[model samples]
Target: MTINNVSLSHHGGEEASGLLEELCDAYADAYGVEPGEEKTVAFRRRAEKQFSRPGFALVTARDGGRLVGFTFGYTLPAGDTHWWGGVQPEPTADFLQETGSRTWVLSEIEVRRAWQGRGTGRALHDAVLGARGEERATLATGPDAAAQPVYESWGWRRVGRIPGDEGDYYSAYDLFVLELPVSW
Candidate 1:
């Protein structure tokens, strides 16, 4: 599918909440998982929580009025033990300090299966990250995910891995971080 006609838009949390179903559909299609399954259910709940975060942001791409892709994240709370607790190889003290600012946690980026390689995902990812005011951004991806190379190419570096949680969506994932421009 050609993404030449795709349009991108940034949405605030309230607006993004309304797009949850469409976002879940895109995620399900991309991952070959059925909606309402264990992982999908968990994801839906997480997305809802993420949308309510203080610095929540979402960027979406639509092709001819249909949602094709989206990416969303929120600023990480400083000193939030819940997030840092997952780091496999503990990071340095500076990295662990949150101050309720510092890092933007990219929770999810998904494109419909039919739109995988047409740049929809990139457009959405870049749109979301480009709008963040945080000093850096972080995301976790399955160790062998197809997007790993894309993240690396975009200047993200692997920091460590987080062990899988019981009944979680991912078994284990490598954490990646990228420093963002002070001004964008």
Candidate 2:
């Protein structure tokens, strides 16, 4: 699909697995992750796990076939207590009842440095969510202006925070949630 002159493509996790190297390249470019570093390897491993989950999907933005940005995620199953374990304020049981259809967890989103501020990220975000059937979505990013302000501008509200985990890529981050369209 073409959006604002950038070509957008959607893929199931299986197919997306083949593009991990390229996806990582885009990630490294956007975040300054040194090539062949431990963090890069860890990110790849995480991406693999994400791809293997049920309801997984990926969307990529390309400019003449070079990745400019991408977004991907999967739906959470009911009772994923581990996932909710990090939320600062524990959620109520009613809010935790997912039934596997209530939430889509956006695992990764990035726009290459060259493409930043030109709407490429927004385009990729909209393309992915626009294709999702879930009633709502959530994502986590660092709790700072440099990290989450853009998400806030896009309508996500910080519902809570996740304490940093013990890992190279782990850090305390604010959790944001957004409701998807629901026509009565």
| lDDT, candidate 1, 1-184, per-residue tens | 2447998988999998899899888888878899877777878999998888979998888888998888999988756656666787888888878877788999899888898888787777777887777888899898899889999887889999988788765788899999985232
Question: Candidate 2 lDDT, tens digit per residue, 1-184?
Answer: 8877899999998789899999989888888877478767887888999998878999999998898999999999876645566687867777667878888998898888999988888888888888889889989776674758888788888888788788835577778888885221
Query: Per-model C-alpha lDDT, please?
Result: 0.84, 0.83
Q: If scored against the real structure, what TM-score would every candidate get?
A: 0.91, 0.92
- Weakest lDDT window of 10 consecutive positions for candidate 2: 77-86
lDDT of 1 at 86: 74
| Cα misplacement distance, residue 46 of candidate 2 (Å) | 0.7
| Per-candidate RMSD, Å | 2.5, 2.1
Judge candidate 2 against the unseen true structure and give its global Cα lDDT, from 0 to 1.
Answer: 0.83
